[model samples]
Every structure is written in C-alpha cells, then in structure tokens.
Target: MSHLSPRLMRAMDVAAHAHRDHRRKGNRVPYISHLFGVMYLASRVTDDEDVLIACLLHDTLEDVPQEYSEGRMREEFGDRVTGIVLGVTKDDSLRDWRTRNEAYLRHLAHEAGDESVLVSCADKLHNLKSILADHEVLGDGLWSRFNAGKEQQQWWYAAVHKVTSRRLPQIGLNGEFGELVRVLQRL
Candidate 1:
C-alpha cells in the first residue's frame, strides 16, 4: 500500500499554492486539477510517495518558476522529489516549441531516473486524457489551445509514448498511453 506522510501533504500545499492562479489552456479549469490528476494516476501504478509527490509538482518549475524554484523545491521536498520534478521540467527559456521539446526528450531518455519516468508517464497520460476529452467536445478547434498545432502535437505525443514505453515497458500506463497516441494520430 502507498504511504502518505506529512511530506506528501506539504508537497500538495506547495503545488496548490504555486499553481493557484493558473488555468489550463483553452479553458478556465484550475491547473491544480491537472496536478492532482497526475498524482492520482501515478498512485494507481506505484506506492512510492516521492514519485507521487513529483507527479503533483511536475509542472512547477516549468510553469511557475516565480512561485517555486529548484532551490525552494529542494528545501521543501528533498533531492529525490526535486530531481524527479526537474527531470520532467522543460527549459522555458527556449522559445521555440520544437527546440524545447527536443531538449525535454533528451533529458527524459538519458538523464531521468525510473521515478521520473513513472511520473512522466502519468503526467503524459493525464494530459492525453484531457486532450482527448477536450477534442471530443471542441473538435479540431482544440488544437488551437496548444502552442503547437495538431501535427506538432501528434509528433510530440507519439515521440513521448515511444520513449516512455521503451523506458517502462512493464507499466500498464505506457500501454494505455500508446493506444491514446494512436487515437490522437487518427484525429
């Protein structure tokens, strides 16, 4: 069974506060909902609290550096959780979406640990679910929500599934992610 210590509760506060004002793209849904969704999905696959915490805070460094930095995260959650969060974070300084995503893919393939991979798979899975759900309602208009359009989005999700599935072939989430990527490809 998974244990939720005080540390996990503290991480929840940190994530909720950091993303308090943010909303998901193309809609007004609270961004913290996505964080919680990732944590819940990761929880389904593993009991490691650190991985679950990383799932909660995965987007902090990328989305809200002003609210939470690497140093602050380390001070609050220790190295392992911080490392996993860093593993999934992309360098926002790179303005070009392709350049940013390429760097992220390299980090995911070479530098991320198993914990990071697990959190990333959960993160992507939650994102895919959100995208598919939104697409069903918004149709092609949903593509406008992202920085990159449909083709680029397809490329990125497919590439992520390829890397994540290879890294974690045993995880059932990867299988689901691959299937979702195929569904997205057809749209």
Candidate 2:
C-alpha cells in the first residue's frame, strides 16, 4: 500500500483533473510530475497534512483554467489548503512574465505568510531542479521554452530563494531550502 492519507489522495485527484491539459515547458512531461515532486519535497520537510495537500494543489489555481474557483477549492479541501493554494497563486491578469514574477516576489516579501512560503518553497525547488535537469540536455534552447531567458529565470529563482529562505529558519526547514538555493545558484 502507498500509505497516502485520504485527504492527500483526494487532493491529488482534484489536482490531476485541474491540471489535466497542461504539459511541462521543455518536454512532453505531464505537469502532474511537478506537483508530485513538490508534494514529495514538502512531505519530507513537514508532516503537516495541509502542507502536503497544498503542495499537490499548489499550481492548480495558477495554471488551470476556470474549471475550479477558490471557493470551490475551499469547499472541497477546507480553508487552510485553499488558503495556501491562493497564497501561492499569482495574479495572472498582469501581461508580461517579468512583471508578473516581480509582483509575485514583491508579494512574497511583503504579504505572504510562513505557511505560504513553506508551500511556495517546495514548488520553486521542484521547478529549479527541473530547469537544472533540462539545462543539462537542452542548453540555451531550454530558455526558449520559458517566458524568460536563462538569466531572468535564474533571477526569479534566486529571488524566491531569498524570500523563502528567510521564512524557512523560523520553520526549522532551512537546510533543504538552503540546499535548493545552492543548487539553483550553481545551475
């Protein structure tokens, strides 16, 4: 048996349907792998069920279409899980990549709470690891798949690392975040 909590299994089911149409940028990989990676990392750092469930659903509100509203999510997953998803959700109406990312980093710095950062850190760590892996094979071509180039991508990850790192010490999960930051820096 896989031993997943019933709540987590339900979260994964919802996230799978929500992200069903999406694919990773550089390859044909399903976006669900990214979600699972975030969940795996977050589960490693903390046993909090809400955190784990949030990790699975983290990208749903941001990436999926209007299939699931925040209210609907709250109805399905409760306040804490929905709140984490909303906290990590970006303002999508903003036009450009840099502008959106800058706004998100700003929000992380000024508005987001520690629980929000905890979930966001796992998502960023998984993304940076994918970027590093794709960079190995795709080289400069990999940057073309994303909204920004290598330098801009690196900047965004570094920025998230900075904001997320400060929050991690308080949560006592600083080492994992630190290691992710170091790997991101090296990449």
Candidate 3:
C-alpha cells in the first residue's frame, strides 16, 4: 500500500485550494499539475512518506494564498513538514528574483541531506523539463525570460549538475533528466 496517509491527503487538498486560480507561465495549465509532476518524479526515487508529502506541498507557502501561513502549515502538518516546506520556500523580501533564487539554491546546496532537496530537485527538474518542451512551442521568448543571462544560465546548469550528481545517482544517469542536463550545459 502507498504510504500517503490522511494527513498527506489533507495537505494536498489545502495546496490545491491555495493555488486554485493559479496557472503556470506561458501556458495556462493548472499550477497543481506542476506539483503533481514533481511528486511523480520524487516517487521514482524514494517512497519516504515525508519526502513525498514535501514534494506535493513544496510551493504552498511560496505561491499559494497569503492565508497559508507557516503557523497554519505547522498546525495541520506538524513542524517537520513545515520545516521541509520552509527550507525550499524563497524569501520574497529580496529586491531581485535572481538574487532570491540564487540564495534559495545556495540554501539547498547547504542543507544537503534534508528531504527538502529531493522535493526541490524534483520541482526544478519538472520546470526544466517543461521549459525544454515549451521551447519548441514558445520559441526563444520563454528562454529569454527564464535564462537571466549566459552567466546565470551556466551557473544554474552547474549547480543542478552538482546537486544531481551527488544526490540522484540511484535515479540513474540516463533518460529525460540526463538529456535535460546536457541541454542546460549547452546553454
């Protein structure tokens, strides 16, 4: 049987509510679909219940309704789940998106073994894969907005390589992820 319990189910419901009106950039697909994709990818690695739950709700505190406070998250899902979610949540007080993202990535790189990394990587891999797929449809505009610049792009590729190289060896060095990494390196 799957390890997803009633608490996880409730948490997913809360995330769905929080992101109800949201859509991904470029395409208007429901944002929760992205969360599902990340969870699916994480499932391919370890079935650690906390990791799966974190994958499902990683963005709730960041992208969801303002009412979804850390306190509410702790009350509903307990402190550990809140900690994992907060570990991946970006501090929006930064003046620039790139600075915020860089700090977030640096934090992840520092907090190496936290289950949050698995969710964060799965989340990033999902976005990267979508960016690759969307590139054919959106053309250069999407890449232009997402890439930040050649140096930032190269740093991103290198950072992803460092994390995945250390953490995802069991996920194998083949398939969509491997191809995506190669493409990022070329950018």
Candidate 4:
C-alpha cells in the first residue's frame, strides 16, 4: 500500500466517513471511490502532496453538509487545503448556475500555479472521464445531465478546454478525457 502522511490519511478517512452511504449517479458505487479516483489521477499527474490531499477532500465541503464549514476544514487540514476545497465548492443558492460555474473556473485559472488548480483539474478530469465511461453504458442520460442547455454547455466546454489547454498540459489529452471533450463540443 502507498504510504500517505498522517494529515492526508486523516483527510481521506474523514471524507470516506462523510460519504459512506452515498453513491455516484448512474453507477451507485460507494462515493468514496470517486474521491479515491480523483486523488489517484492527481497523483499520476503531479507529485504535489497538497494537491493529492485536496483531491481526497474536494467533495467534503460541497456534498457533505455536516463537514462543510471552512473553519473546521482549516482546523483539521490547515489553511492551504481548506482554501483549495473552498475554491472548488459551488454555491447552490446561486440563481445562475452558469455564472457560478464560470466564476469558479475563472478562479481556478487564476490559481493555476497553486496546488488547488491541480486538485480542481484532477477533480474535473475525473468527473469528465466518468461521464464518458457512463456514456458508453448509459448513452443519452449521461449527456442529458451534463448538457444542461446549449449556451451553458458551450460555455463550460469552451471554458474547460481553455483552462486545460492553458494550465493543465501535465494532464495531456488522452483516453476517455479526449473523447469526452469531443463529445462536449458535439453537444
């Protein structure tokens, strides 16, 4: 087994516990598996310890209400990891999801040199890869959840492409991710 620092191991354990009963859309696999997938991908792309930890904890603030506080994250994992997680979490109350997404992407672009960007890119890449895999199995429903609408979809597609092209050359286009980008553009 790969050895992780105590802090990182604790973050993974906390996220796993928080997401214990949850399952991914369509597949229904234990949601912690998704977190592990993201971290694994990040480890492949970058050796940054903070990025790996952030990937492990990425969904904790967004999906787990009880552990969503910034202060709690900071206290447990320190400011850097908490900031990265916070940077990626969406505000569901926003009336305009596209605008919120755009803002978040823009923030990621600005933070490109930070470990947060690596973590966020890994998270998005993992999600896009899963969608592509599900497309192979579930077909249109995968597109439906992601498609949203033409303008929103186009904006996200273009935005992610722009960011990936600019910031994530380390995670080069390959395998399912390349296909998913093509699928997004076709939508």
In terms of lDDT, which candidate is strongest?
A: 1
TM values, all candidates: 0.96, 0.90, 0.85, 0.83
Give me the runs in candidate 2 sitting further than 4 Å from their true place: 170-187
lDDT of each: 0.90, 0.80, 0.74, 0.72
Q: Residue 158 of candidate 2: its Cα lDDT?
A: 79
Clashes of each: 0, 0, 0, 0
Clashes of 2: 0
Candidate 4 per-residue lDDT, tens place, 1-187, comes to 2578887788788888888888986567888888998899878766667777888888888788685566787887788887777777777676587777877787777754456666666676677767667767876666566427445655575676567656755565333355567776665
Order of the predicted models by lDDT, top scorer first:
1, 2, 3, 4
Clashing pairs in 2: none
lDDT value, candidate 3, whole model: 0.74
lDDT of 2 by residue, 1-187 (tens): 1368787899889888888888888678998899999888787668888888888888778877487788888898899888888889899999899999899888887888777898888888788778878878877787788778777877788788888877666654456556766766665
Candidate closer to the true structure by lDDT (higher is better), 1 or 4: 1
Candidate 1 per-residue lDDT, tens place, 90-158, comes to 988898999999999998998889899888899988999999999999999999788899999999999
Comparing 3 and 4 by lDDT, which wins?
Answer: 3
lDDT over C-alpha atoms for residue 2 of model 4: 57
